[model samples]
Target: MTLTSKQRAHLRGLSHSLKPTAHVGKDGVTPAVVRSLLETFQQHELVKVRVLENAPDSAKSLAHEIAEKLAGAHVVQTMGRNVTLYRPDPEEPTIALPR
Candidate 1:
């Protein structure tokens, strides 16, 4: 799903206090990392993933790659080594996104 500036801003605020759910290291976005992220999404729509300095790619690229692998996921924010992602549950989305 494509998010407007307003929606992205809203999600950014919601993820501010959230700690990094998955940490990407030298392994980059491995299957294990993707699995963990998927599991994290099961509980929370907004998830923060931290890319370690040793990670192969930059935070932006890693975030985009991860978003693509996950169904209907979007990159909400990417700051420094931190990447915030959002993917609401298809059946029942908990977070109410503004138009």
Candidate 2:
């Protein structure tokens, strides 16, 4: 689902205090990384990912690749080597978005 600017901003605020749960290294966006993110999405609608200096691509590109890999995920924010992603659970979403 596409997020409105307000919703994206809300998500960004919520994600500020969160620590990165996944990391992208020189391996880039591997299947293993995608699988880990899928597992993370099961528990939370929003997730933060950190890209190491050795990563193959830029943070924005990696974020998009990550969002593309996950079925309904969206790129919420990308700052420096960090990326915040959002994907509401299909069965029972945890975070509510503003209309």
Candidate 3:
């Protein structure tokens, strides 16, 4: 699913106060990291991921990698060391995107 501009903005706004749930360390995007992302998606639907200073790649690359690994997740925003992703949970979606 694709996020419209308004929806992206909405998600971005929501991310402001959210703490990073997953951190990409020097190991980069490992299977363990992806697994954590999956759990984050399952629980939070929308989550913030942080790329540490020692991470192997850029935040954008890590965001895309996370999105690609997950089924419905997409990168909504990225700023400096942080990136936000959204993947609506069919069971219980807490976020309401702008149409």
- All predictions: root-mean-square deviation over Cα? 0.6, 0.7, 1.0
Residues 39-67, model 2: lDDT tens digits: 99988899999999999999999999999
Q: Is candidate 1 or candidate 3 better by TM-score?
A: 1
Candidate 3 residue 94 Cα shift, in angstroms, is 2.1
| Model 3, span 1-99: residue lDDT tens | 799999999999988999999999999999999998887677788899999999988999888988998888889999999999999988878888879
Which rank order by TM-score, best down to worst? Answer: 1, 2, 3
Native-referenced Cα lDDT, model 3: 0.89
Indicate the residue-level lDDT of 30 in model 1: 96
* Backbone clash total, candidate 2: 0
Q: Number of clashing pairs, model 3?
A: 0
User: Mind giving the per-residue lDDT tens digits that candidate 1 earns over 1-99?
Assistant: 599999999999999899998999998899999999989998989999999999999999999999999988999999999999999998999999999
Ranking by lDDT: 2, 1, 3
Q: What's the TM-score of each model vs. the native?
A: 0.98, 0.96, 0.94
- Relative to the true structure, candidate 3 reaches a TM of 0.94
